[model samples]
Target: MLKLIRLEWRKHRFAGNFLGAGIAMIGILLFLIMIGFLDQGTEDFAFLDYQGSFILIDTFARAVFIIFAGVLISKLIISEYRDKTMNVMFTYPIKRHKIIAAKLILVFIFTFAMIMVTDIIMGALLLAVNQYYGFITEPLESKVLWQMVVKYTISSISAAAMSLIPLFFGMRKHSVTATMVASVLLVSIVCSGFSGSNGPTMSINSIIIIPLTLGAVGLWIAALSMVRLETKDLN
Candidate 1:
């Protein structure tokens, strides 16, 4: 498994996706902060409030990283099939399921780490901005910062796991479009429905459980697809 992951990393080491994601992360954070400043009069805007700002940032970060994960899965997995490199992979001695697992594991780790790091950076930047501008109602407190860290941690993990949903579509026909489309829809639903003024529709615990459950289902489908791959003609 480690070997497979190493090989996957080598394949993507030169790819511009990571660099692009990094740029996008910074861009998105700045954009959200700008909106907060521009919309200061709009109390309904979640970014205007400190706690609301964190919630907005967390929701947006999750959505962006989830889409980024979908793109990674599409490029890493679907593109292999599209380009006929999957047949080359099939020739390897490693079990097909192990290969799939390794790829998924890489996606999960990358997505989770990116979201967590970006969220932390964005949160800190917003706090600093608030300190200078006095936009936030409450002063920055250690207890509040700790709560943000915990919430961000949970949301990041859940977002990373949920990203595998696109894998199910990717495996079906090796369609990158399908994977991206699924990601867009999922992100829209998650961000628009449960985030912001509406707040989470369910308990915080359910938010974590629901995405994790869906991710597990997606992995189960990927395992089943691997079984099919064993018998299906690679040609």
Candidate 2:
């Protein structure tokens, strides 16, 4: 399994994806830092508070990385099928199911890791900026930071799994458009936790429910697809 995963990693270095993610992360960071300065205490900026800021940042991270996963599904999986490279892959010694599973594993790990790391970096910047500007004015404590980390970690896991849901759509004819669109819609649904309001829908208890549920569904679909790939002709 490790060898297969390493082979998939070698096949797609994801350099473009990493560059794109870095650019988006920088944009999110700039927005987060500037958000404090733009604060006017209006309802428009209500989600600019500590927790709300975290939610907003997490939302951006989730949405970005999920789409990143979608692009990866297209690049690593669907596009290969469309271009008939999958035929070449099947001719190799590797089992069909193993090949797809390896690709899925890479996607999951990459999405989860990127989301967690990005949130941590952005959350730290939020803390540092708050310490300097006193914009949020909420007393920072070790517990609060720990809580943020816990929440971000959970959300990252959920998002990474949920991201694979698009595979079900993409595999129906290997339509890249369906895969990408499904990802966008999935984000719209799961990320509806906050808007410009003071009452953020993203609470600790509510955080894990939707994403985890859909993530399970995605995993089931992926497993089923792998089973089908064992017999389905790639020719």
Cα RMSD, each candidate: 2.9, 2.3
Q: Whole-model Cα lDDT per candidate?
A: 0.75, 0.81
Question: In model 1, which regions exceed 4 Å deviation?
Answer: 194-206, 232-235
- C-alpha displacement of 32 in model 2, angstroms? 3.3
lDDT of 2 at 55: 83
Give the best candidate by TM-score. 2
- TM-score: model 1 vs. ground truth: 0.87
Report the alpha-carbon TM-score of model 2 versus the true structure: 0.90
Evaluated at residue 188, the lDDT of candidate 2 is 82
TM-score of each: 0.87, 0.90
List pairs with backbone clashes in candidate 2: none
Candidate 1 lDDT, 1-235, residue by residue in tens: 8988988889877256679778978788778867766766764655555666676777777888889988888878889888999888878888877887888889889889988888888888887777787766667678978986887787777778778888777767778999999999888766664444533233232356666676667567656766777675354
User: Model 2 lDDT vs. the true structure?
Assistant: 0.81
lDDT of 2 by residue, 40-60 (tens): 666556444677777878887
